[model samples]
Target: MNIPCPYCQHPITPGATTCPGCGTSLLREATPQSAEPTCGYHPRRLSLAICDRCGTFACAECLRLNSRQEVVCQRCHALEQDTPLPWDLREELGTFTAWWKTVVAVMFHPDTFPTFRPEGSAGESLLFAVLCAVPTSIVGGLSYMGFLSFVPYLLSSGNPSRDSVPSWLGPAMFVAIMILGPLLSAAYTVIQAGLDHLVLKMGGVTRGFQVTLRANAFSQAPWLLGAVPCIGPYVAPVWGLVARVFAYRGLHRTSWGVALAGCLVTPLLSCCLCGGIYLSLIRTLGGFN
Candidate 1:
């Protein structure tokens, strides 16, 4: 007589104690039949081995039985337990837009933009922007007017002498530069600071207003190189490009769409504002005549 092996269903001699196909132990005596295997993922198989993480049962087909008897679903077991989800651009943009509104409001009133410190209010950032802009604009405007005077001196074919330049023109240019230049610089800086604040609030630590300002300052080095007459116009774009780079970096931390828009529009806006001022002054001086 012969019997079927319990492990591999192979036929064996009646006295055989193990399955030849799988090396599994055979019944020593006739035993009762057992139930079918159950799926590991199903909840009804509570008595079966289950995955420790996702809580799925283990069976011959569903079981990921390992040497240690530790079993888990293939999908859940392979996932990285510590990895965080990627940031959502839309959500970041929304947060940036909200922070932008706050910045605008604070610009109108210095009391609004808060500071990170205990004594600092929301307006501390705005205050810093104003302080930096005032001095930088004053110095920058004076330097620009001084540089412009060189054009006339060069045209006059005279050794550049400050005394020869018209005194009234210098003071007039100074006043004009002081009045318009600081306001423009202040506004631009405020906008940048606001954008940086927004980026911080949006869970981005890669870029900040201080970093942007430092980068801009470094980029302006090329503009000084623009002092070479014919090269001035060509090199001037470097300053504008630097500004756009800062803007794009800030936007990149927030949203790619916003960065794209900023890269296209910021230079144009700066040109319009600064150029309009320059052209207006020229017209007032009868340069159009």
Candidate 2:
């Protein structure tokens, strides 16, 4: 069994009084009791420690190290670790409400992200990404279809000679996109997560690809704001990138520099390469002229 040194989070050998890695003393005197009390969790065992927060009597088996490095009772530890986030309230609040609340929390209360238990698989993460992407993808697609279907007619309204796109084309395009767009977005999420995983690994994250994938998935929550008419296209991309940075920093338990480098480097490089290609194409076309 691997346990962490309370001071440095380095591995510690079991039953050791001092951390071999950090040389920090782990031995502590449990607050002495006048009379042996029954443990709160294990009634049969004599209490050896008292919870610093609640003053509950707990046996060795019922004691845990809390964030403050104080010995806490199992109940108190559970209270802190199991406080439900909005994401975990899906059944009670309904799917859309839960998702919206989660998005709001991620945007405004990012410190909560670190409290989120990272236990999901990559497929689960990608599915969440797909759901988040659907609203935006459909909204943007329909907006485009509307512009494509009606903008020409609006421009040519005064002229009777010009024709508008067939009425069937608009609904057809919208339907096709509503069906296919989410799938493509989910596929892209998988690819994007895999790419981000490489960068995160280089930055010293060892929690594996699923952690990165989940972070990437939750980051997509901001895109749901894209359903809010025209502003979404302009707003979601920038905010989503910011969210991803925080998500990585929290999920991987890494420094901000590592998180930012892992999250931004590949994307920035891709942008530079694409810009170069665009400039080269422009120069080639200019030469042809």
lDDT of 2: 0.76
Please report how far candidate 2 places residue 167 from its true position, in Å: 2.0
TM-score of 1: 0.28
lDDT for every model? 0.44, 0.76
Candidate 1 per-residue C-alpha lDDT over 1-289 given as tens digits, one digit per residue, 9 for 90 to 100:
2344555777644324456777775432222353544444443432233465467544333434332234555554444122211111225556345334433332233221111111112233333334334444556567777876766667567555556566567557767866775466456655654553454435443444554443232223233333345656485556445444443443334354444343446556667999999988989889657
Q: Cα miss at 265, model 2 (Å)? A: 0.6
Worst window of 10 by summed lDDT in candidate 2: 27-36
Best by TM-score: 2
Clashes of 1: 7
